[model samples]
Target chain A: MKLILLLFLGQVAPVEVRAFDTPYDAGGSITIIWEMDTAWVAKVSRIGIFRASAPGLQDSLIETLYKPDSVYVDNSAKDNVPYYYRIVVYSDDTLIAEGKTASAAVSTQQWFNGKRLSVLIILIIYTVFLLYFIMRARTNKNLYIRKIAGLEAIDEAVGRSTEMGRPIVYIMGLGYISDIPTVASLAILKRVAYKAAEYNAEVVVPCYDPIVMVAAQETVKEGFVEAGRPDLYKESDIYYLTSDQFGYAAGVDGIMMRQKPGAVFLQGYFYAESLILAETGHSIGAIQISGTTAVTQLPFFIASTDYTLIGEEMYAASAYLSRDALSLGTIKGEDYIKMILVVVILIGALMESAGIRILTDFFSIF
Target chain B: MTTIIWTWVAAFFTLAILSFLYKDNPLYKFAEHVYVGSSAAFTVLYVWVFDAYPKLVIGFKEKAGMQKYMLVIPLLLSLFIILRFIRPLSWLSRWSIAFTVGMAAGLGITGLTQGFLVPQVQASFLPLFVRGETVGQTVLLTMNNVIIVFGTIFTILYFYFSREHKGVLGVSSKVGVTILMLTFGASFGYTIMARISLLIGRIYFLLHNWLRLV
Candidate 1:
């Protein structure tokens, strides 16, 4: 039994270690190689690499390698700084063996260093413009903004549904409650529910995720409560159908067919099911307003829906719905930065076309 | 003759699908049903050949060496998934639901930590400046590396929740959020531009390739 225990320990031991020159990129990196013992082949766990400034100093754990591989490259060392490296091997819960330290000093690479100059200039310019806008917006400067037609039409959509004596259907697309896009969707939900409560119209929300269904229920309840019509909120209206993407689409299609809602609102992230849902709403002669950041689904929505909020417009919906100052400020800052970008692009293009290298050079000094 | 036949078939299917944009008619409905049926059949065949046969059945036979009995569990589980047909037995599908949810949660947590958190933290911790041979290098760090490292640190702090953002960190994080928003907006604009370009390309194709127009 003692001999068998010894054999097991030996079989699980860390493999031989060798230091090799780091290749391809630069001399700043060092590569270490090892061999895994056969007995722990499938079960052998991650390798950990530790680095130290000096031989006698305590080594700081630099990185953990999860792959069951025999090689690791330490790329964190700086130029002219003497460094020591070590590796720890593991099998399941057992630390099988640890390798000895290897020392090296990182050397500089000129070509790689020079290639990054243009990138630095671009970043600096972007950062400056971003800071400028943030400061300007903070001071509460008057900013001209165009009205978003979809946001302006929200009241009209809800009012029409109330007048027609038909329900307003709110479909939260296949996005998790935690995602920023879904948060925006919920914000819109609150607004729609509030309008529905005031107008005394039925609001129906069918969800794809259980968590989102719960959040939607809470948001709608809050909206009704805030509108002083808490009695009008129905829990059954906010319900989960299925997590399956297409299955939820089919269910919503059936709901649209049966109920014939006067207004349909599609918000949050959607995929292939977007067109099917939008087309179904269109067929029913409902006023369809859709918003999503999913670029692929945007075209289909635009072609089929009455109004479609394109990309960042969806992000701006929460602000438009709530009139939140922070969100409005962010949007204004975004516009300013966009203007700066247009100027830079035009200048860069003109300089390149005119063969004036100095303009490009001067621009690079950001 | 072969080219002509293939062109006609392609045109028919294209017209059928495109007709849905105008209104849902019988031709569009037929095309839609055909598409759905073909997709479902393809999915079943794919899962059986790629996922089920190899990963579950053959995997159990090779790795666990419990072939016949293990296969029984999966076969029953699959049948349970189809239990939606019966009203009473539908609740039996909870076993598969629980198993899938538990496994997915475990895998998602592992992937989130590995793919996002750890790498991002490590990437952010890289040194701002490295010694170079020239004075330009000493004056400024590598541009791409600087932006990546800077972006990572500020973005992380932008999501920090320990204290109210009021001081230097708050101001910096506010700036960071602005940068992030602008980048997102710019990327969105570029993406729309690319899509519009593609739409133009498709229109060009239809006019030039299908109709033989210049």
Candidate 2:
């Protein structure tokens, strides 16, 4: 049908149409290019574009475009379906020339986005360093991480709670079970729980997430089990209250107010509620040690809490607390990687100043 | 027809929650419970209405080729995660979690590198001094860039873990701590401003919207 229409309109005038698949895209796009014949320039006032899917029974008029608008991208093309495009010339609402794609075209998926090669390159660079460090870590178990003060204070805090004869309140902030900082918080929770068990101090953990509650229960149980105080581990101690941020904060604040717990462990992913929890713990005269990966909430924790694992130091804190060689090695590796990044940045800047485009351009995203 | 009644319901819940400022009580509990329960229900509703129906079901139906059929991958993965409900089959959920954690790590690397690292490095290449400009503007821009350049380097150095904090490196790390403290103060001020703004909105609602005393 498209052939017949084009042939019928060919006698009027021939307007050549070019259609090809768009490149460097994920899929589902085609570009159409056409030129208005110089001879037909005076004869035609405007032009139209139409596209039809396979088994073309009809044409869907896409646009009625004017002069100097000869290019269009048919991003509306579907994945599997072949698309045929046409250019129609209208001289005062009369069909003057019609040009259609000789063959049907389908958009194909590209293996890679060449435009984002720089991203892939940098990713490879980071991966190489990570792998190298991991390999080196297998050998270098002697690697040392600087002493994180917050972690060292964990024992002191737990001991203080034991001495005061008050329960230790450990609140895991409202983060999903899968959040990295939350996982790290749970590790530290285990450490604190073990210390509490050893000291025969009751450890009260109020969880925001039910999943985290179950996890924390298991963790604290393990801590007591490891401490050879299985009899002291009570399932009722670690309980789920509510997941709502404010509600959890209020619940924690209530615990802090009523018990005036000797030591409060505020750790994990907290948002606006960081200040609330820390401030409440402070008001209760509890020795608070807080850590969060949330950059925005750190200052509140710093201002209110006694010891803070600043930023990424929370991850290092877990390894530091555990005193695991593998974890220490990984932290050391990460430090080395940071140095590499620093060097790269400095070199890139110098190159930029020197008008040496090679280094800077190679790292350019676009 | 229900607009006035709806307003009353909202206002009641608002007051119930606000009452917590005095102390936790039954009203506060009622409001908090309602918030949690409704939020959970809304989450289910959203997954069904927006996500499950539109993205999964409709997409499966509308999708024509390999890409459309590939939707089964995530579907199967989700079903595996649902196995956690069955205690004996709970170990199967680990596969799903592994997939999620793996994808998150992969995507996080991409996001952190492109969204943060690259743009940050690119943005830091500001000129040390402005050429062919008035001294005031030149001095201001130069100083701004200078602080940014030094602060960025120093802050990163402060977080540097491998080296012992002694000598020249120690001095820079100290400077980094100072910069970080200044940044924390700025962050606190900004955050407090936002919180105060929210408080102002709540106060306005109590005065005009609910109490109608304005």
Candidate 3:
């Protein structure tokens, strides 16, 4: 019937239109796709989408899109309801040809996005690796982990401060508490605080975020408590500075100049002020140990600091320092996954070179 | 006259900050204190105007039904965080912290996986050779693809920590380090250029806008 109507309208090209529930979506949406020749596309000024509640019902023009759009998603469609759609081709605001779907499109909600199947698979495999090792860690205590110089130097940095009779300053950069790097920095700070408390030395932590300030205070207090020196923990040492980037840098530079800390730990996320802070620490004659995931700032830290934790090394600091069986196991699992990914990439590249798309097709979904 | 006065003030502050390059002086300290103090005040006002006022006060006024009532949860959470100053009620603040950490960790993992991990893996699937129209073009394309594919593989291998870097793994990781160092070198040069551009902007402001020497 749709074909007959198109023929009656003197349309030469066979009008094909489909309206269906969009896949890999949260639902209440129908996707309309139509085919048009490149030649016909030149004559089309706009395309109109018409929707009706039922077949043979008067459909209202829902949306008119510019030419070159072969697809349209109607997000306002009701779930589990059938929607009849018609595609009208217009030339200079005049309707030229139209196509209607032979069957209705129904929108329904999906529990899981099909497009994220690969991500789910990877997550499940990685989780399995973690869980297996975490459990196995109870028995297997001989996991061989490589040495990270930045983490290894923490004790030495703290000891240097103790010997010099100067406070150790730990800058948590400008990351809010929610950032992964900031959270990772908290773990490293706890270790530093513990060492400082053991040496009866002061550890000053100037925070960029208020919430991080509180967390740092608690972490320091915990470290002191663990060292059996809770009395040494000073709340004033872990304090909030301005959240403004340059303001924080200026404030920290001031602290470094006045206090003249023997050692400085620059950890977590940093921006333009990374060099300013590092350079200030250098001028103060402090031993600086820096770690961050910021690719751009790593060079500044590497250039100025005595030891630098590059990229993933910062994330692995806690696991490396603690040397807890479980943490080691997790690292082992991560390393294995990295190895697997390398293999996957190699095989993918080889296959792609040979004009095979098995792996490519599998991971092609956005 | 007002513009001139403000420009003079700005120039003085800028000069004061720059003087720190020579040594930390009283002028630098004075300028730094003013910057930090004003920044703190500005941050408080910014949060109230943009965050708390809009999300809470206006939400209570404008939002209807369930949404309006739901705002109470966030209000209570905010109070819990502020309750830390009371000492005795500091423990309550941990609840808010815990909620934020858990939510952030969960969101961070899923967000990174979807946005970074999958996209990166897909992008890395480059063909090792290309069939361009010319031999030179083909060779260039193939070389580029090989560099990308192997560069990515080796760099990833470098990050593996469970095993010691020795033998073949050591060589691969070494190559990775070399590549990473090269990248950092380029980044350093690029960032230095940006910093110089900023300095030029400040100098331009001093000369063109303030001093009017240009």
DockQ, every prediction: 0.02, 0.33, 0.78
Q: Provide interface RMSD per model, one decimal.
A: 13.9, 2.8, 1.1
The 0-to-1 C-alpha lDDT of every candidate, in the order given, reads: 0.69, 0.79, 0.90
**Candidate 2 TM-score, true structure as reference:** 0.77
**What's the C-alpha lDDT at position A54 in model 1?**
80
Highest TM-score against the true fold, candidate: 3
C-alpha TM-scores of all predictions: 0.46, 0.77, 0.95
Itemize residue pairs with steric clashes in candidate 2: none
The docking quality of candidate 3, as DockQ, is 0.78
The digit string of per-residue lDDT tens for model 1 on A165-220 reads: 99999998988755556777888889999999999999999887765776787789
Q: Per-residue CA lDDT of candidate 3, range A235-317, in tens?
A: 99999989999999999999999999999999999999999999999999999999999999999999999999998898888
lDDT of 1 at A259: 90
Ten-residue segment with the worst summed lDDT in candidate 3 chain A?
Answer: A1-10
Q: Just chain B of model 3: what TM-score? A: 0.97
lDDT of 2 by residue, B46-151 (tens): 6689888988999998998998988998888778767756879866766666676567656777887878777777677655555437878777877887788778
Candidate 2 lDDT over residue span A42-76, tens digit each = 65678788888855568788777776467888888
> Candidate 1: misplaced stretches above 4 Å?
A1-103, A106-144, A348-366, B1-214
